[model samples]
Target: MHHATPLINTIVGGLVLAFLLGILANRFRISPLVGYLVAGVLVGPHTPGFVADTSLAPELAELGVILLMFGVGLHFSLKDLMAVKSIAIPGAIAQIAVATLLGITFSTVMHWTLVNGLVFGLCLSTASTVVLLRALEERQLIDSRRGQIAIGWLIVEDLVMVLTLVLLPAYGKLLGGESETMRQVWLDLALTLGKVAAFITLMIVVGRRVVPWVLAKSASTGSRELFTLSVLAMALGIAFGAVELFGVSFALGAFFAGVVLNESELSHRAAHDTLPLRDAFAVLFFVSVGMLFDPLIVIHEPLAVLATLAIILVGKSAAAFALVKLFGHSRRTALTISVSLAQIGEFAFILAGLGISLGMLSPQGQNLVLAGAILSIMVNPLMFALLERYLARHDPGDEETTDRQPGEETQLPLEVCHHALLVGYGRVGSLIGARLAEAGMPMVVIENTRARVDMLRNQGINVVLGNAAKPEILSLARLDCARWLLLTIPNGFEAGEIVALAREKRPDLSIIVRAHYDDEVAYITERGATQVVMGEREIATSMIALLQLDAAKLPY
Candidate 1:
């Protein structure tokens, strides 16, 4: 009984190594993406170690692509894209053109054919959505004008790449042989487009009604496991059906499935429920890409690796900066957008793989793309750090400071003064918020959950959506103007950080924090919490008071 399945071995090995490296990367203040790639290289065939099953890795990586695109579709908002269309659409197109041109010039210098050059160029033209979103969310910039513009631009780039993915095979066939005429190429393209259009129409018309109904039924059962299973089934089922029936890419099918599901009220739960699986597969996707990379490229083809990095870090960034500035935006906006786009990730790897499958890209090109992705991801945080410093010194009155004022059409009340700033809208915080609302007291909630924020807003409660640990998010809650800061989240260390920050921002602000342990209470209080309420301590106090009352009621 030979039970040593290669699939199991690959998954186990990849995940364990990736976890170890990811932690190391975080410890060093580097993106976990860099670590994941490094892990892949370590377990790769090129390295002196246990190699994973390369054959199964790609299939798993495809699943990751489907789930990743589906998640994107869930968060996708046409309204947000339209709001910044004037700048985002044109700026993204122009930047992609510039990047592609630079990539093509480099490819030509390397003596590649025009078709190969175009494929290579296309890979370099787009930025990684995962990296961009993580960066923006970490900085609490996801809702800012600058973040909106950058996100909108990335959306445009994604749509273009999706279209390219659909059309590339036909283009490849035409370029590969004389048997395929230009007319044949156009005909094949039209047929592919027709299938895609038909698939999208089915999703919008029928899927929109069916998916929500399925989820609603699943929700009615009140089974968390069933609901999670239903969401995953929808994602994977639609992806498979699209390829089997419509001759479309799994990524496109999964994306449209997500867009359809996004219309349902259960969409947030769907996203949250399936996040763990999505994240796991996404990591595997990165690991698979790393497996394809040969570290000797740095030694054997250093110039080619450098050229790829230049296109990603310098050429693409310069184009984005020029495009944003040409649209009459400020220097800060230009810099933000530029730095945001200065890395490549999942999409680049997907494109590179497709190019290789179609015989349009060489092994060397794929390795170069992988090398560029790793290096650029490693350098991205430094770029952001430099930008932050520049803004602090030169643009001292940047948006974070100036935009804190009320009457900016924000959810916070303009007339409210000495209001309570409530952090975390979970169990304890929600109870406190309900009491304050009943008493007609002014309150603003700082919560990171989007679904909770939406619910609060619908009830006419003011809420700020972001991690409260960040100063910018706290600033958005107007800490200086707040009279009381309440930390209802259970994490003692995190709560302490928030207390310290609030105290520094407003020395006179009263702070109350909840803790689960006696040591946590002491820790929070030492960090400047005016009051630390421990659950066990309060329970004991109530019990003692009740015992005394009972004794007094007795004859004694």
Candidate 2:
């Protein structure tokens, strides 16, 4: 029995195309988002191929946006933002204003209305969180002073976008209204602000207390599936309820739900559990944006497309550079900040989608936004690569600069010397770290998880906050004076990379790595790992020794 399943077909088609193109993009060293967007373009109504059900894509895309926002809220760290507030806050605002002005100017030249121009400008003003973070991570700069500033700047942009999402509809109505009085506009604006404030306050005071408790109880059941279900329910339920009761957007509701849940210790687990779903939905979100994009716009309106790209890549970059430099930061810092934010991504799509739904922005405007996004994302990695090469030639002392604050380094004490490098802080690494502590060995730990990093810091354990695969992160451990490089992380392929780097740095350094399988053991060993501890082999050996001891006791 065959079924005419529009939803199933849309999902299957989207995922299959996304995976194929995503792999291709990754192979070419481009962002996977580009591939997902391209996949949408191929399968869209505008293209000559199997078209996904257009009616179903947008609704799925909305779910994707909600999950993306929830993930953002889950990872939000106020402390990180506060560290770079001096530059990040003012810098982000000024850059947005500049980008918006450029967008509005282009719109004026194209004969669009001011309201449409405003919506278009706002969409162009923000950069992709995913792209910026991935770039920083690749270079091992996520914990550096420049990285912190970039992240804080992004947080400001996100908060601004959230507020923009809430006020845009009301603003649209106010602008479009012919019969509305000044008093009525004021009343409507005040009412909207009041409702937003009420939602935030309620989430902070009540939802924080209740949401975490519910999650904790779910987690206590020892059922991973149950905990995962609880998280989804909270995210989707709160989003739906916020629309019904507080009259806010789903994005805002999901964002608040995540923020409330973040207060829980199990928040990390919740985030880890929901990551696959969030990523799937996020991919759908990009695909939906691409589906709306008309490729012939580039052919028909080449000048408009170029202008939009200029606003994003050139205008926005120039504005950010000027702001960062004006704040008395180093030129390197300014360049990094500017180039890192030269592309627009998910938020742009979300804002444009909202504008379309409100009848504020034309389809032409949405098409332009999508075109700009695809082009900017495709070019951003090249920009980063050039920036790195340029910086390398101009400035050799990138890390030892005067701009780095004391806290920018890991919580390791300055006096600690000749410490071993311990990568990972999970179940296996934790046990290993405990043993190392008992042996009175001073060591530095490399970890990626926020929760684990916090716990390690609380215990006065020195830790670097990034993946060990990045050479810059490994360098932070002072490998020159280190006695041992312990790759306790579970992934053997990643461990192989670390081992290779360590061996190249210091041939005499003791290197140890963990493996789960025989193939992993062989791979790590081939990569110059001095020791490979296979868990299954060790378990069998221990069991045999215990059996021998039992047999000896019986004979005696």
Candidate 3:
């Protein structure tokens, strides 16, 4: 058989299985990632049919992670991380430390080898951004306060994961060599870290600036194929540079490269553009991880796998929930945020694979980690679905309430409302929607902009495509039952007329009307509005409310 034929067959088989399983996953309300991992396990070499040649799988897996980190780096600016530095840096370190210590403790009790136990801890320490991000995106909660904080916190974990990869190889190499001493191992470890530090400096000074320019230049050539090729080239180049030049794994280099590019202007473009390739390669990475799982090991060491998963998902979530709540979000917000961060992420695959290569993990230990990864990815979405339902009942407005950033009204409309009725879906309407959403109120948003309506719809928000000042629009919004009506349009005369008309019709409609300036307030008031809320006055009132609220009692 031609070498290319087996590779092609393997990829084709895996993809087909993945597609089928993904369909099932979606239909069943489960994450498609679960299906992808299962597909990998089914088609892997350890199984019978369509066994993928995994020798190249790990290398390809490296590209997948690189693309992922590249997207992360391009978007995750140090400034953003620094903005949340108080939480991200400390939260990431603390979580990893706690998880690792627990893993080590469990391993000691189970009598696993010290090296293998360390590998176990390393594998279990980090959360999977891919799993969590996908789940949040699926639910349209990606821009929420909790989601933003979770992403920032994940970056911190990525930093630690990268450092661990750089340090582990040297430690593991000692076990494979003849008559190695602990002192030499420590020295190699020091030198390995030093090399990584130097490599990071070189990348920052050189690769970060150069790579984006290379990508931009390629993009300017007006060739999609060329642009795709360029992304891979940069990712591979950095990965190769780290491994061949610095003795660090390609994943480590890829990560630092991403961190550097995170500071660039092209981060969002890079993320949006390279998604297909990242997803394609990312699929292969998970499949490769699934292939690493051994059923026999689970039969023999089921206790270990369960123990590890329990500590990682549940124990870790508890810690994160407490940490986030302490940081000032509501318990509901903290719960959702913590649940989102509960699973071990795709990057764990990278760390574990490197550990396997470096002899830090025994064959069984590797299998255990692989199984844990599969299970975690599988349950992440379900866990989120459960959590969402739980929060809806217990904390209905958590995501929307925590979400505050606004933009030109988008087509996606998943905005939650509270005691407010939004009239007009213009910039102000959408901005107010975002704010009211963060406050956890059920709001009925009325808008007439088709493009904006479409954008709000896409965002999974509650919206009516009509003028709220109209009687029919007000009726559609169920204004008779509404506690507050927010009017945000430029037609003061039209609004005044509508307000007069509404007062005549309903007589008890409590409406908050926005005016351009103070002089318009009297006319608005004369029209029978309960209150006139100028944008300026509203801001002041909100600030006062914020000031009055107990910061210590803030729900994250």
TM-score of 1: 0.79
Candidate ordering by lDDT (highest first): 1, 2, 3
Prediction 3 global C-alpha lDDT: 0.70
Error of 1 at 159 (Å): 2.4
User: In model 3, where do residues sit more than 4 Å from their true spots?
Assistant: 1-4, 140-144, 169-209, 246-269, 345-362, 398-556
Highest-TM-score candidate: 2
- Residues 1-556, candidate 2: write the lDDT tens digits: 0485888888988889999999999999777777988998888999997889887897897787677667656655445546689899899999999988888888899899887898999999999876776677567676567877887788678767866876776677667775656676577667766877898889888998999999989988999899999999999999888878877767768877987776466765677678788778777866776776778989999999999998899999999999988988788888899999999977898899899998889999998998998888778888998998998899756453445654454333234567778997766788889999999999899876566678888999888776677666677777777888888776677689889988998899999888888999999999999999999999999998887766556864
Q: Candidate 1 — which pairs collide? A: none
Q: Which ten residues in a row have the lowest lDDT in candidate 2?
A: 406-415
Cα misplacement distance, residue 434 of candidate 1 (Å): 5.2
How does candidate 2 score on lDDT?
0.81
Cα lDDT tens digits, model 3, 266-292, are 444456568788788787777776777
C-alpha positional error of residue 67 in candidate 2 after TM-score superposition, expressed in Å = 4.8
TM-score of 3: 0.65
